[model samples]
Target: MASRVTMIAHLFGAMATILMLVWLLHYRGGIDLDSDSNSDRIFNVHPFLMFFGFIFIAGEAIMGYRTVAAERKVQKLFHMVMHLIAITLGIIGIYAVFKYHDEIGLSDMYSLHSWIGLGTFCLFGLQWLFGFFSFWLPKSSLATRETMKPWHIFGGRALLYMAICSALTGLMEKATIMGLKRGNESRLINFTGLFILLFGLAVDLSLSLAY
Candidate 1:
C-alpha cells in the first residue's frame, strides 16, 4: 500500500514539475537570469525551485524508508542527503524572490504568501537541525532518538502541509498579480496547484500507511 502511494506521489511530483515549466515558459516568458527582464525571470526561479527542488525532493525523503528496500543506515543517509539538497535549493528559491523584489524596488514579505513561505522555511531549517543532531549523529542516545522520533515525524508532516499551503497561496497571489482570469495560463496554474496538493496527499498517506 505504502509503495503504491509512494509511486503515485512520484508521479504527481513529475506532473507538478511539467506544469510549472509550462507555466513559466509558455505563460510567463522563458527564464533569463542576465536579461533586461531579469526580475521576472528570477521570480520564475522561486516557483520552479520551491516546487521541484524543495517540496518534491522533501516528499521523496519522507517516503525513502517505505519505498526503498535498502538497509536502515542507507535509508537514513539517503533521506538526510535528500533533505539537505532540498534545503539548499529552498534557500536559493527564497533568495530568488527577494532578488526579484529588490530589482523591482518592491518591499519584501508584505504579503501573506511571503509570510507563510518564510515562516515554513525557517521551521524546516530548525527541524532539519533537530533531526540531524537527534538521529543522524551518534552523540544522542537511543532513548533520546526514540523520544524525538514522534515529534520529528509530526513536525515534518506539519511542515509539508505548510509548504503546500505556501505554494498554493503563492500561485494564487501570482495569478492575481498577473491578471490571469479564465485563460490557459490560469488553467495551468490551477492544474499545477492540484498536482502539488495531490503530491502532498500521497506523501502523507504513504507515511501513515508505512507506520
Candidate 2:
C-alpha cells in the first residue's frame, strides 16, 4: 500500500510538471492568455493551471517524508527544524503575493508567478537531489538522518502548497480586477489535475502489486 501511494504521487508530480513546462513555453512564445490584446488585464487560464499544480508537488513530498520516517534512519528533530524553516519562507512568500497584489497587474503577476514557482521548484529540486544522491546525511548515525529529513520534507511541501495558493489567489484577483468571469478558464487546469491524480493512483497500485 505504501509503495502504491508513492508511485501514484510520483506520477501526479510528473504530469503536473509537464503542464507547467507547456505553460512556460506558451508564455515564452507570446501566446497571450487572452486571444486579443497581449496587455489586456483580463484573467485567463494560466493562474488556475499554475496554482492547483502544486498539489502534485505536495503529494510527492508527503510520500517521500513517509518513506524516510518509516526507515527510522534519522532523528525527528532535524526534520522538524527543516520544516519550520521551509514553512517560514513559504508563509513570507504567500504574504508577499497578496501584499503586492494591488500594485501588480495580471501580466506583471505572471512574472511574479514565475519567480514564486521557481522558489517552489528549487525546494523540490533540492529534495529530489537529496533523496537520490543521499548526500543530505552521512552514513554515520540515525540522528543525522533525522536532521536531514525534516528540512527535506518541510522545505519541499511548504513551497508546493504556497505556490498552489499563490497561483489560485492571483487568478481570483485578476478576475476581480478586470471584471471578467473566467471561472471556466480554470476548467482545463481542473481536468488536468484530476487526470494526473487518477493516472498516478493507477500506476502506484499496479507497481505495488508487482512489488
Candidate 3:
C-alpha cells in the first residue's frame, strides 16, 4: 500500500514537471522564435509553472523521504533540497529578467540570477552523477561518501534558499506581465500547490504510523 501510494505521488510529480518544462521552454525564458512581447511579459508562463511546480515537487520529495530507510533518508532529503533550489533559481531568473527589461543587455540582476541558476544546475548535475555512479564506488573510499553526503547537503540548502528567492522573483515577473496588475490567478495557482503539498504531507504522516 505504501509503495503504491508513493508511486502515485511520484507519477503525479513527474507529470506536473513535464507539463511545466514544456510550457516554459517553448514560450517563456529563452530567446527562440522571437515573439511580440516585452521583457515584463516574457516570463509569464515560465513563472506560472515554476511557482506551482516547485510546490508540488517539493512536497513529493518530502513525503517520499518518509518511506526510505534512515541511511537513505539523508540522500533523499538532499535530492529534495537540490530540486527545491533549482526551482528557486528559475523563479529568481524570472524576476531578474523583468528587472533588466529596459536595459536590453546583460544587466547586473541578470548576471547574478544567471550565476545562481547555473550553480543550481551544476549541483543537480552532480546529484545525478552520484546516483548514476552509486553502484560502482569502492567500499573503502571516503571520497565518495564525503562528496555524496556533506557536499550534497550543503549544496541542497543553498539551493533551497535560492529557490525561495526565485519564487519571489517569479511573482514579480507575473505582476509585470499583467502590466503592474494583481489578480487571483497566480494566487490561486500557488494556493492549489500549497494545498496539494499540505495534503500530501498529511497523508504521508498518517500512513507512516501504519507502516
Give the alpha-carbon lDDT of every model.
Answer: 0.91, 0.47, 0.49
TM-score of 2: 0.40
Give each model a TM-score. Answer: 0.97, 0.40, 0.43
Candidate 1: residue 184 Cα off by (Å)? 0.8
Tens digits of per-residue lDDT for model 2 on 104-164?
Answer: 4423335554566656656655665565445343553677666765675455446545555
Q: Positional deviation of 5 in candidate 1, in angstroms?
A: 0.5
Best by lDDT: 1
List the candidates ranked by TM-score, beginning with the highest: 1, 3, 2
Positional deviation of residue 177's Cα in model 2 after best superposition, in angstroms: 7.4
User: Clash number for every model?
Assistant: 0, 6, 4
Per-residue CA lDDT of model 1 for 1-211, tens digit only, reads 7778888999998999999999999877876655474478878989999999899999999999557788899999989999999999999888888888888999998899999999999999999999998898899888888888999999999999999999999999999998889978899999999999999999999989977
Cα RMSD of predicted structure 1? 1.0
**Candidate 3: RMSD over Cα atoms?**
8.0
Error of 1 at 8 (Å): 0.5
- Candidate 2's error at 128, in angstroms? 22
Off by over 4 Å in 1: none
Model 2: residue 204 alpha-carbon error in angstroms: 13
